[model samples]
Target chain A: GAGVSQSPSNKVTEKGKDVELRCDPISGHTALYWYRQSLGQGLEFLIYFQGNSAPDKSGLPSDRFSAERTGGSVSTLTIQRTQQEDSAVYLCASSPGINYGYTFGSGTRLTVV
Target chain B: SQELEQSPQSLIVQEGKNLTINCTSSKTLYGLYWYKQKYGEGLIFLMMLQKGGEEKSHEKITAKLDEKKQQSSLHITASQPSHAGIYLCGAVGSNYKLTFGKGTLLTVNP
Candidate 1:
């Protein structure tokens, strides 16, 4: 891909329902990152994947949030029992590695009703 | 807790005016990167500085990292309306995560 791509550019789900967001990073990118952006706010780091190793999930807000990168390419972020506070733009970015500039996706705007 | 803090949460300036935004970190930063985001849009990478006392410029924008490595500044000269957007600074640490500031929203009126 020419740039990072995310699925379901917009999602509207009722509270208590689970939702999944997907990210396909730039080809050959070794580092993938997930961030959440609240309305009129800056991005909040959610998780990061470096190559095929275990992901850095320390940024996840809670246990209900989990992410996995398969084959070090496509990744999925799943949020269970979504809360109104969870409504925000979910962004994905990738870089050759963390030391370089990151290319971000268009982002998925998730809304919990 | 927010590890990074940016000043001037919002600024309104006339076209052709110059402006500067500052970012300070509580911990020493290994790297600092700046990004811009338009309303309802993804972030666009602007610049990155790795070493202290390093400076880089692109067109009308120039960024500098202090020798102390605790602060950074983004200066836009002869700014244009196109430069209107939210500016954010991120600091990378040993944990390999880029902690971002709340951002400074700039509006350049023509």
Candidate 2:
């Protein structure tokens, strides 16, 4: 893991409590992504795995937002009952397929007060 | 549903002056990404245009991809101040998911 690796970079939950964000990609890099950046908004496409397929949640913006990618390389993004617009910053990217080009991490700044 | 449109949303150059950022897409673009952010963190992979008039550079930043691929452009020749920040444009959807464009805030007033 020389790149993509996210964790609790900064979090201050409160609203409803329930926040778990983690992503460790770049190992074999099969493709995994989850994004959200509210403050001024822009990158918002939360959910997409590529190895075993079946994960393109369309862009989960509801259902309390959820994500998972186990045996393929570690990934989790759960935002159960957090509101306050759900704070911001929460990105994680990894790709080594589909043409290749993606390796982002250093995110997870959710602050719901 | 791959829509990306980024234009002069913010810019204020001066140090060596030379800027140009634009990313337009309404479809067509199996791959086209260029990102740079330093405001809150995350994202820093610049360059990736798929075929059709593709172009890439990574020293003074230079990207272009238009020929019906919807459009893409990001040029920063002499600009300094570390080239400011916030500049995004990603498009590669339909299954691989990757749709962005709402960034373009570079200020290098040195």
Give the best candidate by DockQ: 1
TM-score of chain B of each: 0.97, 0.33
CA RMSD per model (angstroms): 1.3, 13.6
Clashing pairs in 1: none
Write down the lDDT of every candidate, Cα atoms only: 0.91, 0.88
RMSD of 1: 1.3
Name the regions of candidate 2 deviating beyond 4 angstroms: A1-11, A14-16, A19-54, A57-88, A91-109, B1-14, B17-29, B36-38, B41-50, B55-62, B65-74, B78-83, B86-94, B99-109
lDDT of 1 by residue, A1-113 (tens): 99999999999999999999999999999989999999976788999889756456788999889998999899999999999999999999998976799888989999999
Worst 10 residues of 2 chain B by lDDT: B91-100
Model 1 chain A weakest 10-residue run by lDDT: A50-59
Give per-candidate clash totals.
0, 0
TM-score of each: 0.96, 0.34
Q: Stretches of candidate 1 above 4 Å error? A: none
Q: What does candidate 2's lDDT look like per residue over A60-107, in tens digits? A: 889988788888898888999999998999999899887888989989
lDDT of 2 by residue, B23-105 (tens): 88988998999989999889898888998898889899899998898888999998999889899999887667788889999
